[model samples]
Structure formats: C-alpha cells, structure tokens
Target chain A: MKLIGYFRSGASYRVRIALNVKGIKVEHAFRHLRKGEQKSDDYLKINPQGLVPSLLLDDGTVLTQSIAIMEWLDETHPQPPLLPKDPVNRAKVRAFALAVSCDIHPVQNLGPLNKLAAFGIDQANVTRWAKEVNFDGLQACEALIAAEKGPFCFGDTPTMADICLVPQLVNARRFGADISGFKRILEAEAACLKLPAFADAVPEKQPDAE
Target chain B: MKLIGYFRSGASYRVRIALNVKGIKVEHAFRHLRKGEQKSDDYLKINPQGLVPSLLLDDGTVLTQSIAIMEWLDETHPQPPLLPKDPVNRAKVRAFALAVSCDIHPVQNLGPLNKLAAFGIDQANVTRWAKEVNFDGLQACEALIAAEKGPFCFGDTPTMADICLVPQLVNARRFGADISGFKRILEAEAACLKLPAFADAVPEKQPDAE
Candidate 1:
C-alpha cells in the first residue's frame, strides 16, 4: 500500500497512527501541502479533493477521508482492533473520532484558515478562532468520555478515538489553548504517548516531518 | 426511538433520510436552530457538541454524529443496507460519503457561517467562500462518480454517498449556487427525489418543515 500524506495534517496523522497500530506496512508518499503539490495534476488524479492522506490499497483501490481510511484499515487489519467489538460501543468510538475529525479539524484546516485570511481577518482573530473552536470541539470530547470510567476513552486499550484525540490536542496546544481542562481527553492522549507505535507516528518523527 | 433534530440542518437531514430508508419509526423532537434551542440545557445533555440529530435508541443508547447513527442503524436493522456487502466495496462507498460529509459539509455548516460573521466577514464573502468550497467539493464527487457511471452516485440504488449529496445540494440551492455544472450530482439527487422515502424525508416535508 502507498499512503500519500502531509506531516502536519491532523487527518493524515490519524491515518498514520492507525496504520502503525495495525502493524500494516505501507510506502509513504509525502505531498507537501505548503509546497502546493496536492494541486498538481498528477496528485489530483489520485484524489480530486486535492487533500492529503490518500491511501492506495494493494488491489489498487484508493481511500480518501481520514476517518473513512482509518475505519477501512481497522476492518482489513483487525488486531488491536481500532473499534470495540460491540456495535453500540463501536459507534461511540466513531462518534468521538468524528467529533474531532469532522467537527473540529476541518474548520481549522489550512484551506479554511486561508479563507479567513482572504476575509481580511487579523492574525490575532484567526488564532483566536482556531483556539476557540479547537477547545470547544475538545471540550465536547472530554465530556463524552466522562461517561465510561476511562483511562482511555473506552477503557484500558487505545481505540480509534484515541487516534483522533492526540493529534487534535497537538493542534490545540500549537495555538496556546488550555487543554488541561479537558481531563479525560488529556488522560487518554497521555496514555497513547507511552506507546511506541503512537510515538513513532508523530509528525516530527516522520521521514518527511516538517 | 426519538430523534432530536432541527429541520434543514444537514446533519439532522442525514439522519432523517437514514431512518426513512431503514423503515425505522422515530418520534421527532425538533429543536429550532435559529432560535438557539440547540444550546439549551436539555439538548446539550443529549449532545454535548450542541449539534443537531441525536438519535435516542430503543435501548436508550443516545448516538451522536449522523454517520455513526446511520451505521448503527444499518447494523441493528439490516434490511436495506446503506453500505455495500463486501468490505472493500463498503470502504469505497464510505470513502465517497466521507469526502462529502467530513470534507465538504461541516466546514460550510450554519455554525461555521456564523463564525464568519463573528470574524466580521460580510455575508457576501461568506456566501462566496461557501460557493467556492462547495464547487470544488462537487467536482471531486463528480470526478469519482464519473467512473461509476451513476444515475445514483454509486449505481442504481442510493447509498450513504447519495444521502450526503442530497442535503449538500439543498445547501447549494439555499445559497443560490449555479449547480447546473454538476449535472451528474443534480441527476443523482433527482433520482433520490423519485423515491418515496427520500421525498418524504426532505426538510420541506418534515413535521417541523418551514
């Protein structure tokens, strides 16, 4: 499998963590978003959205959307299952993941930030927007895991929800947001950092890490 | 089962369609988004994200996130499956769905548009941003379905991809977008409209329809 990705993209980072957790071997193809390589014709053919983290399956199928890609990887390579076995529990895991991946990350993404710049919003306000939205998004996630007595969001094992939480909190910290208030989320991410697979998947550790 | 939703919220609309397609009966609880009801203590207790479309399961499992709710419904009651049978095919279908659900819709939702206003972006530029992003997103969808030769996005029957498409087109039309350029998508939505379940499930026909 060939994974086309960018280092700082939270979506790509989630996929990276999932691949590592599943112990799947994939060739990394970095498309630097800062360099505008994703807009190039060759890459557009791979993903029309011009987004990073397009996973090319061994059978030549391409999977886009980091949430969908993560789920696909979980289904195909099930050990250390990214989802809990029960369907209801599985949905809860996905809901937490989507709460971060869908509700938070997309709005603060590079394209939307650029759109803010286009709207003539000041740098202070843009950073404010990022921090505010990211915190609000994470707060909901923190509230979610408080349901189960969680060291990890679901339990002792790190599932797909943790994969999403760590990267989003990384984004949250970059803006100087106070994530220590989000107790469960902070604890879950802290648990993940102790694992080698999770540590190795961090953006700074990647070969093309910016 | 009961669904806490607001008419015209794309997320809420997605659950409406899924319930209809699955032939599941849901007691409707409408929260007026324009009235700020989603922020109420009652609603927030159900969905901490203050988002629309929380599905209260028969067993009292309150599921958030339209995709998660849809998938859970599919698993618990599988007659008319929203996903394809094979794993790879299901993954491909979900990848297409997420391309729209996660990639396109969330960033352009009513919440984000309000964020634009809070940033002092004029309504015109906000509309412009929505148009540009939606068009780029539609092109991505069009490019993918072009290979599948769709009357619907995937084939003859509607899938999760089509569920996502219809609401997005609703947003496009609400914004006065010139979507004739996206003939395939428009055609796919039309085919969806022909189904009783989809037609009855449209926002205009809902119990709380405006």
Candidate 2:
C-alpha cells in the first residue's frame, strides 16, 4: 500500500497514526500542502478533491476520507481492531470519530482557511476561527467521553476514537486552544503519546514534516 | 427507535431515507431547529453535541452523526445493502458520500451561516458562500457518478452516496445554486424521488416539513 499525504494535515495525521497502530508501513508520498501541491494535476488524479491522505492500493485503487479509510483498515485487518465488538459500544466509538471528522475538522480545514485568507482576513483571525471551532469539537467530544470511563476515549483498547482524538487534540494544541476542561482526554493523550507507534508518527517526524 | 431531527435538516433527511429504505419505522421526535430547540437540555442529554439526526434505540442507546446512523442501519438491516460487496467499489461509493457530508454540507450548515452573519457578512454573502460550496460538491459528485455510469450514484440502486447527494441537492436548490453543471446528479435526484421510500422521506413531505 501507498499513502499520499501532507505531514501536518490532521486528516493525514489520523491515517499515519492508524497505519502505525496496525504495524503496516506503506511507501509514503508527501504532497506539500503549503505550496498548493494538492491542486497539482498529478495529485488531483489521485484525489479529484485535491485533498491529502489518499491511500493508493497495490492493485491501484485509491481511498479518500480518513474515516472511510480507517473503517476499511478495521475491516481488512482485524487483529488490532479500531472499533469495539459490541454494536452499541461500536456506535459510540464511531459517533465520537465522526463527530471529530465530520462536524469539526472540515469547517476548519486548510481549504476553508485559505478561502478566509482570500477575503483579506488576517492570519490571527484565521487561526482564531480554526481554534474556535476545533475547541468546540474537543469540548463536545470531552462531554462524550464523560459517560464512558476511559484510559482512551471509548475504553482502554485504543479504538477508532483514540485514532481520531489524538490528532484533533494535537491540532487544538497547535492552534493555541485552551484544552484545560478536557481532563480525561488530556490523560488519554499522554497515554497515547507514550506508544512508539503514535510518538514516531507525529507530524513533525514525517519526511514532509513542515 | 426514535430519531431527533428537524424535517428540513439535510443530514436528518439522509437518515430518514435510509431508515425508510430498510422499512424501519422509528418514531420521529421533532427538534424545531428554526426555533432553537436543538439547544435544549433534553436533546443535549441524548446528544451533547446538539446536532440533529440523533437515533435513540429501544434499549436507550442513542447514536449521532448521519453517516454513523446510516452504517448502523446497514449493519442491522442487511437485506438491501447500502454499500457494495467489493472493497474498491465500497471505497468509491463512500468517498462519493463523504465528498458531500464531510466536505460540503458542514460548511453550509446553519451554524456556519450564523457565524458568517456574525462576521458582519451580509445575507447575499452567506447565500453566495453556500451556493458556491454546494455546487462545487455537486459537480465533483457528478464527475464520480458520470465515471461510474450511474442511474443512481453507484448504479441503479440508491446507495449511501445517493442518500447524501439528494439531500445536499435539496440544500443547493434552497440556497439558489445553479446546479446546471450537475446534469447527472439532477437525474439521480429524479430517480431518488421516484422511490416510494425516498419520496415519502423528502423533507418538505415530513411532519415538520417547512
């Protein structure tokens, strides 16, 4: 398998963390997101949306959407499952992941941020917008983990929720958001960072690390 | 099962069509979004995120996120599968779905519109933003379907791709987008409209239909 991605992309970060967890290393291709490389013809051929973290299969099929790719990973490689076995628990896990990916991340993406910049919005305003929405997502997710006692977001097993949460939290911290209210998640993040898979896969460690 | 949603919510509309396709008659608990009812403590107890299309199970397990709910519906009711059997095809179908739900719909959501309003953006600017993004999504989706030779988004069947497509098309129209570039999707919407299941689930036809 091959993964095409930008190093600092939260969506790509999710994929890297998942791949590391699965112990599957791929031929990594870096697209320089800051240089407008995602919109290049070659990259657009890989993902028509010109988005990062498009997984190219050995047989040459490409997968987009970090959650969808993560689900495919869970389905095909089950030894260390990203989702829980129980359906209800699985729903909770999936809901948490989707809440991050769907409700939070998209609105604050680089594309939209660039659009904001196009309107003569200052860098501070752009950062503030991203931080504001992402902080809201983190808070909502923190509330979700409230019910389920966790070393991770769902339980201690490091399901898909953990894969999603770590990157989002990383994003929040990077943007200077106040993450003080989410105590349990802070604990979970510390635990997640201790693992070699996660630690080594941090965006700064990637070949294309910006 | 009970679904908490407004009739005109495109996200909720997707789940409603999925449930109808599976012949699952869950109770519909209306949350008048226009009236700010989703912000209530009762709804937040079920879904702290305060997003609509929250599905409450008989055992009291509530699921949020339209994609998660749709997948749960597919898993629980397997007769007419929303996803295809092949991994490649399934990835293709799901990418098509996320192109709207993840990338497009969230940006044009009511909250973001309200945010733009607060940013001193005029109604014309909000409408312009919504139409542009929604239409960009439609054209991308149209390319996906056109490549796959679709009566629906994938084939003749109304997969999750179509479930996402039709609702966003409705939003696009509501925002006065010029969807003329998406000839194939308009065709798909017409096809989706013909299904007794899809027809009955249309937002305007629902109990709280605006």
Candidate 3:
C-alpha cells in the first residue's frame, strides 16, 4: 500500500494514526498542499476530489475520504479495533467523529478559508472564523463524552472517535481556539497522545513536515 | 425506531431515503429548523450536537449523524444493503458520499450561510456563497461518477452514494446551480427518483414540509 498526503492535513493525520494502530506498513508519498501540488494533473488523476490522504492498495485500488479509509482499515485489519463491535456503540463513535468531520472541519478547511478571503474578509477575520467554528463544535464533542469514564473517547483503549478527536484538537489549538473549557475532550486528547500511534502521527513528525 | 428531523434538511433527507431503501419502519417526527427547534434543550439532550436527524432505537439509544445512522441501519437490517459488500467498492461509495456529506453540504448548510450573514455578508452574497460551493463540489461529484454505468452511482442498485447524491442534487437545484453539464449525475438522480424508496423520501412529500 502507498499513502499520498500532506503533513499538516488533519484528515491525513487521522489515517496515519490508524495505520500505526493497525501496524500496517505502507510506502509514503507527499503532496505539498500549500504549493498547489494536490491540484496538479498527476494528483487529480489519483484523487479526483483533489484532497490529501488517498491510499493506494496493492491491488491498485485507490481509497479517498479519511473516515471511509479508517473504517476500511478497521474491517481489513481487525486487531486493535478502531471501533467497538456493538452497532449502537459504533454509531456513537461515528457520530463523534462526524461532529468534527462533517460539522466543524469542512467549514474551517483551507479551501473554504481561502474562499472567505476571496469574499473580501481579511486574514484576521478568517482566523477568527475558523476558531469560532472549532470552539462551537468541540464544545458539543465535549458534551458527548462528558459522562464516559475515558482514557480515550469511549473507554480505555483508543477507537476511531479518539483517532478523529486527536487530530481535530491539534487543529483547534493551532488556530488558537480557546478549548480550556472542554475538559473531557482535553482529557481524551491527553490520554490518546500518550500512545505512540497517535504521538508519531503528529504533523511535525510526518516525513513531509515543513 | 423513530427519526427526529426537519423535512428539508439534506442530512435528514439522506436518512429518510436510507430507511426507505432498507425497508425499516421508523416512526417520524419533525423539528422545524428555521424555527430554531433543533437547538431546544429537549432536542439538545437527545443529540448534543443539536442536529437533525437523530434516530431513536427501540432500546432507547439515540443515534446522530446521517451517515452513521445509515450504516447502523445497514448493519442491523442487512438485506437490501446500502453499501457494496467488497471493501474497495464500499470505500468508493463512501468516498463519493463523503464528498457531499463532508465537503459540500456542510458548507452550504443553513447554519453556515447564517454565519456568513452574521459576518455582514448580505443575503444575495450569502446565496452566492452557497451556490458557488455547491457548484464546485457537485462538479467534483460529477467527475467521480462520470465514467460509471449508472442507473445508480455504482451499478444498477442504489447504494449509499446514490442516497447522498439525490438529496444533494435536490439542494443544488434549489439553489439554482447549473447542473446541466453533470449528465451522469442527472441520469443517476432520475433513475433513483423512479424508485419508490427515493421518491417517497422527497422533502415535499414529508409531513413537516412547509
């Protein structure tokens, strides 16, 4: 398998953590998103969406969308399962991930942020836009996990929820979002970061980190 | 199962189609999104994210996120599956679905459009913001399925990809997006709409549509 990604992409970071957790060794490649490499003809042929973290399977199948890829990994490599077996619990974990993936991340992504700038919004306001979206969404995530006894998002071991949460929190802090009030989320992040799978996938630790 | 939703919500519309496709007899309830009912304390307790549609299981478990709910239905029901059985095909379908779910729909959602308004973007400009995002993302979606032989997005059968596509196209048309160039997508949508499962879930056919 081979993974094409950018160092700072949270979606790519989530997949890196999953690959490490599943202990799947794959070749790595990079697309410098800031430099417009991902939108080049070669990269677009690999992922029509022009997004990072497209995984090329040995059979020559390419997978895009980080959550979909994570679930595929869990199904194919079941050890250290990224999701619980029960259907309802699995939905809960997925909902938490989507709370970030669907509701939060898309609004704050570089594409939309750049679009906001094109609309005549200044850089300072663009940063504020991203942080506000992060703050609201992360607050909801915090509430979702507030009552759980967690070394992770769900329980002692990391699941897909934790995998997604860790990267989102990294983005949240990077944008200077005030997340101090999200105690449960902070606790889960602290716990997940202790694992090498999560630690080693940090943006600065990636092979293409600038 | 009971589903709490607003009739025009693309997210809710996706789940409604999935339930219809899976032949699950879930009771329906409505939250008037324009009226701010989804943000009510009662609804918030059910889904802290305060989003529709939230599915209430027979066991009293609440499931949020349209994709998550659709997957749970597929897991529990099994027959007339919403996804392909093969992992690669499944990822392809899911990636297509997430192209709309994660990228397009969220950015054009009522919440974000309202946020753009709060930023002093006039109503016309806000509408332009939504139309532009929808046009670009749906164009990418068009590219993803352009080569497939589709009565649906995959093969003849409707998978999660078509489920997601139909609602998104509805929103695209509603926003005056020029979808004429997306021949494959339009063909897929027309084919899916001919089925009772997709037809019955149309927003105008729902009880709460106003």
Candidate 3 is graded, for docking, as high
Q: Alpha carbon lDDT of residue A136, candidate 1?
A: 85
Candidate 3 or 1, higher DockQ = 3
Best-performing candidate as measured by DockQ: 3
Ranked by lDDT from best down, the candidates are 3, 1, 2
C-alpha lDDT of residue B52 in model 2: 96
B131-208, model 2: which lDDT tens digit per residue?
888877777677666777667878888899999998898899999889986878888888899998889988878888
Clashing pairs in 2: none
Local accuracy of candidate 2 as per-residue lDDT tens digits, A36-96: 9998987777787888899999988889988889888877877688888877778888889
Across residues B151-179, which tens digit of lDDT does each residue of candidate 3 receive? 78898999999999999988888888898
- For TM-score, the strongest prediction is 3
lDDT of 3 by residue, A14-128 (tens): 9999999999989999999889898999888888889998999998888999999998998788898999999988999999988999999989998999999999888998999
**Which 10 successive residues of model 3 chain A have the least lDDT summed?**
A144-153
Answer with 2 or 3, whichever has the higher DockQ: 3
lDDT, candidates in the order shown:
0.86, 0.86, 0.91
Q: Which pairs of residues collide in model 3?
A: none
